[model samples]
Target: MLLKDKIIVVIGGEGLLGKAIVNGILHEGGVPISADIKPIKDSNNDIDYIMVDITSKKSINDCIEIVYKKYGKIDALVNTAYPRNKNYGRNFLEVEFEDFCENLNIHLGGYFLTSQQFIKFFLKQGFGNIINFSSIYGVIAPSFEIYAETTMTMPVEYAAIKSAIIHLTRYMAKFLKGKNIRVNCISPGGIMDKQPINFIKNYNSLCLNKGMLDKDDIIGTVIFLLGDISKYINGQNIIVDDGYSL
Candidate 1:
């Protein structure tokens, strides 16, 4: 029970990766509270749920207040939420400038606001952990050849946002030096989500395992980062992509 009684707030807790992290926390004896714009159904009653709009400061503050009121302390916060505009996955050429900016505001801006707020609280408490999500695409440019037969190409905005997350984590970690708050990032490879067969094959060929990762593949790292075992780790981006970025 590495986490014991630690209380963790998981942003975007209703989604696939979020749900896996939440379960991992539970298994490690941590208390997890799920916060997202969408309501979570069919989850264990022990899991707390809160509707949150990460882009809204008011909404973010309110969610934190509710959690603090109920749990008295938040030991860690895992931001997996990626609120984006409707044109999120559009082709690069087709993506409108306005939509691109909007997506950045909603996704990166939300991350900034949420982290700023939590850092304030962490400062007061003298200890906190923040785990931000990044992607393999952030480290390496996409392989356009992989999508030859598919209508998919990595979105330009996605690359921008994910790369930004890495720098943001480092910046916050350094700024919080001696403050007892740790900030880190996890850059994961493409999780197996029933993507196009051709894309999957190409992606796997680039990886050491020659396979797309499963949702559970990311759980152990989450547990390690959030727990006391990684006390000396800070300001680092741990890539969990099975050498896919190579």
Candidate 2:
């Protein structure tokens, strides 16, 4: 029970990775409040659930207010909320301005807005933890084909936005060090349930992939970053790829 009674706010809790992080928090005896745009599953009733739109400032503000009113304190924040756009995979020449801005809003603006509001709360309380999400793209830039390979990836927009997030995490960590607020990112490898048959075929030919990818592979890194065990770790992008980026 490392987290024993800590209140954790999970953005995008309705999604696959988000849900896994929430479950891991629960397993460690932490109380989780899921904030997502969609209705959370009924099984999550045992924990707290709030419908939130990360793209809107008012929506995020209102959600945080509700959490503060109920939980009295927000100990941790895991920002997993992001947008999906078809225009993300196009070549540099084909990418549209609107699509790129939308992607930036979700990954970059969303982090700033959420952290801005939460930092205020954390400042008042004197302690907080923030675990943001980035991708392998932040380190090793992947191609548009790699973006199209799984739902997790996209070329210019996602990589650009997430790369910005890695820097944002470091900046926040330094600025908030005196206040005891910690910020870090997790760069997951390829996480997928079912790859397109064509993607698997191409991957096998070029990558020598032996087996299908699983969603559970992303869990452990998340657990470590969220717990007190990582107290000394800050402003770092911890990559959990199975040598895919090697």
lDDT (0 to 1) per candidate: 0.92, 0.79
Task: Give, for candidate 1, the lowest lDDT window spanning 10 residues.
Answer: 202-211
Overall local distance difference test of candidate 2: 0.79
lDDT of 1 by residue, 1-246 (tens): 999999999999999899999999999999999999998788689899999999988998899899999989999999999787877899898999999999889998899899999999989988999999989887889988888888888999999999999999999999999999999999999998879999998888888964789999999999999999999999999999889887
lDDT of 2 by residue, 1-246 (tens): 888888999998888788888888898899988889888666646778889887778888888889889888889899988667566666666778998887787768878888887888889988999988888777776744643645543468777887888999999999986788999998876666576776665444433354334566677777788788989898998876665666
Q: What residue pairs are clashing in model 1?
A: none
TM-score of each predicted structure versus truth: 0.98, 0.88
- Compare the candidates by lDDT and give the number of the best one: 1
Name model 2 segments beyond 4 Å from true: 143-153, 201-213
